[model samples]
Target chain A: DVKVTQSSRYLVKRTGEKVFLECVQDMDHENMFWYRQDPGLGLRLIYFSYDVKMKEKGDIPEGYSVSREKKERFSLILESASTNQTSMYLCASSRGTGASYTFGSGTRLTVV
Target chain B: TQLLEQSPQFLSIQEGENLTVYCNSSSVFSSLQWYRQEPGEGPVLLVTVVTGGEVKKLKRLTFQFGDARKDSSLHITAAQPGDTGLYLCAGDVTGANSKLTFGKGITLSVRP
Candidate 1:
């Protein structure tokens, strides 16, 4: 079975703090994505990487950046955390474009 | 902007009941996918409908894509407590670099 592992399951940070969320997949997938899930807004894409060292901004990429140093790992960075940025973050990997995406267990972040 | 809309944001029913969730869009898509998410876990792929007017079944779960490729539906028969979760619908638009557009999820609660 393919597994996508997230670095943290729960995190709390103060306002103005920097945060990092990591994801690694063992499937040798070519696509990786980061999304934030809210109660009524659904999952909004923040960033996606199609290949190593290449990243693209998604709909809600403001204040967030991504790094893909290796094919199996992708990282989401919050430059400065704010209260409004608190939400459940999800990571996903796909073998190719238009293919089924396998997701990691989400990381719930709370910024105070 | 491509957008997918899901109806009935929340539904609570007794076990053995039947229910249907609808996903609609004005723009046509190459494929539509249904996912179920549980607490503390990532959303799992339930089904994918690629062809217009296609119907697929997984045990008690039935999925259909509209002939125009602009809509989709998921129907559950004899829903059990295990079926309680969040159901999300996503659409993959045609053309290269197709990014998925997700709809606000439907929260389903089944009571015994």
Candidate 2:
């Protein structure tokens, strides 16, 4: 089956450390997104890319950045991980604008 | 930003019982999608509704979109343990970004 794969399922990082979360999709989709899911806050979009090397900030892009160096690979970066950054990070890819998405298994990050 | 609100954030029901989850939004959307997510996994797309007052079904699950395209609902018949998961609703806002706005999600637990 086609898939959007995340490199890690669980990650633990120390405060002030730089973190990288990678996502790869084999579906040859053009839209990729990064979202952080929290208990009460829900899924907040951090960044999204419509094409390779093109990135746009979402509603909650603060403290996060993204890189889409290749069409199949998208990476989310934390300049400096903080304790408050602990949450489940999800990566999704879609065929085009407003299309259904295929999501990764998600990376649960715990920052201490 | 467009927002989708899911009611009954948490629900617990016995197997074989039926339940319905609601998602409401003030802003009209071009389309709405429903997803089911199991623990440790990302949300999986179950159905997508585009036109106003549209209805779709998949097995024991039924989905309905509002007449104004501002709300949606998911009804599950004969709830099983497998149906227990987080149900999320997302709306596709019309704009250049073409990103979706997700709700906080409803957590359903079906006791066997």
Candidate 3:
């Protein structure tokens, strides 16, 4: 079955370290998104890409950057990880406007 | 920014009971979606409603979109242990990125 795949299920990062989280989808979708979920905050979008090499900042993109080098792969980068940045990160892909999203299993990152 | 507000942040009920959760938004959305997420997993799409005053049913679950396309509701006929999860409502604004604005979500626990 078609699915979105995240590179890691769980990650531990040190404060001030640079971190990378990868996501790939096999459905050939044109849109990819990265979101960080926290308690009482729901899912806050960090970044989203509608096409290859195209990226747009979401509501909470202060500490995060994203790359969409290919049609099926989107990557989220943390320039400098902090303790407050630790949260459940999720990746998702969709066909186009008004389309349903297929999400990866998610990565729980703990920063210390 | 568009925001979806979900009511009853937490709910606990016994099996065979019925439940209804509300999602309201002041901004009119082009489409609305409902998602369910279990522990350690990403949110999965449960249903999507695009038309105003639309109602859809999936087995024991029912979803309704408001006449103005600004709100939605989800109702379960018979809650089960397997129905326990985080329920989120998302609204898609008419834009190029098609980024979705999500609600804080409701945590439902069904006990046997």
Q: Which numbered prediction scores highest in DockQ against the true structure? A: 2
Off by over 4 Å in 1: none
Q: Chain A alone, TM-score for each of the models?
A: 0.98, 0.98, 0.99
Per-residue alpha-carbon lDDT of model 1 for B1-112, expressed as tens digits? 5388888889999999999999999988898999999988999999999999999999999999999999999999999999999999988878748467788989999999
What DockQ does each listed candidate score?
Answer: 0.76, 0.84, 0.79
Model 3 lDDT per residue over B17-93, tens place: 99999999888888999999998999999999999999999999999999999999999998999999999998887
C-alpha root-mean-square deviation, each candidate? 1.2, 1.4, 1.3
The collision pairs in model 1 are none
Chain B TM-score of candidate 1 stands at: 0.95
lDDT tens per residue, model 2, B1-112: 5378899899999999999999999888899999999999999999999999999999999999999989999999999999999999988876635788888999999999
Q: Which CAPRI category fits model 1?
A: medium
What is the Cα-based lDDT of residue B1 in candidate 3?
50
